[model samples]
Target: MSLSSTPPNTSTPIEDPSVYLDDPNRKSLEIDTDTHQGPALFRWLTLGMEYLIGAILVALIVSVSSNVVGRALFNHSLPWADELARMLFIWLVFIGAAAAFSRYEHIAVDALVRRLPLRLAHMLYLLQHLIITGLMMVMIWGGYQVLERSSGRSAIMNVPLSFISLSLVLCVIFIAAVSIWRMWVSLNVIRHPEGER
Candidate 1:
């Protein structure tokens, strides 16, 4: 066969985005990363949360495992272990939630969003985040109020129940900030649907 002008294995340039999108292995095009420089404190705080969550998880595993082994082998349980595991479990849950929110991976039903117009979808998305922010703010306030009465100390650890209440406050703070960030990003997308992306 006669040689064509184009070289071998040279795929045709994509004129329509749909053609490129059909490729399962195609790398995603960069969108908001170019102009989106979030706050320095937010970045550092998320990073610290990553490390803290990891440590808490590890401690939780160790405490539970050791408690199990101690009871099985020595017939004597570590009295502090049950309490330590409980506290660490709470911390782990809250920290893990914060990390998930920061990454925007929390659960949501999005079947309806896919069918909406692009502008309306962005608007609704931002509204969803605003609602979450408002709800979490109420949770944080309520948690603080109730924490005043949960002042009794843990029987084994002697740590006040208020400390556990603080975990709820911390979790909601991260979630609220992340929800706000998501809303801000959605607003930007709505305003500049063509350029910002």
Candidate 2:
């Protein structure tokens, strides 16, 4: 048996400042108002709100399920439980979707994008932002119209339909904000030589 000894290579990692710089194309554009200098406070606020809503949804589901199970096993049903659960489920879907946008966790098809060159990928990202912004604007306008038209209608709980419709407005507003933020970032990457992402 022969023993061989070799020194392992140890080298310091190189840091690239360009990764920290903003894109040149977007430098002339207005800075994003969404991102403030207050210690990322808004992020935490939004996150808290999102989690609270999620918890409410989960609790509603659990309560509804328990009620249903109790009624089935005991031969007595809570008539309102199903309706209440449905409403909460609706709210959960819309609010959760909106929250996804805020956190940049929404599903996106980027398989082709991943194969593209860095510059092209950036351009595609900018295009995606523009498309999303337009879509959100449409949703906001349409939701407002629907709310106005359904002003007199009421849900099972006698709640105004507009209350439910307002969820669309809230979702659109958040989505638009996220889209604008994305656009701002894309523009910055295009502007400053050192800001390329």
Specify the highest-TM-score model's number.
1
lDDT of 1 at 159: 94
lDDT of 2 by residue, 24-143 (tens): 333322223265422253366466658878797777978698787988898787766776676677677778877666654566555676566555666777898899899999999999
**Each model's backbone clash number:** 0, 15
Worst 10 residues of 1 by lDDT: 23-32
For model 1, residues 95-155, the per-residue Cα lDDT tens digits are 8887766644566555676556666777887888799899999998998897878969999
TM-score per candidate, chains pooled:
0.76, 0.71
Estimate candidate 2's alpha-carbon lDDT, on a 0 to 1 scale.
Answer: 0.67
Stretches of candidate 1 above 4 Å error?
Answer: 1-37, 114-117
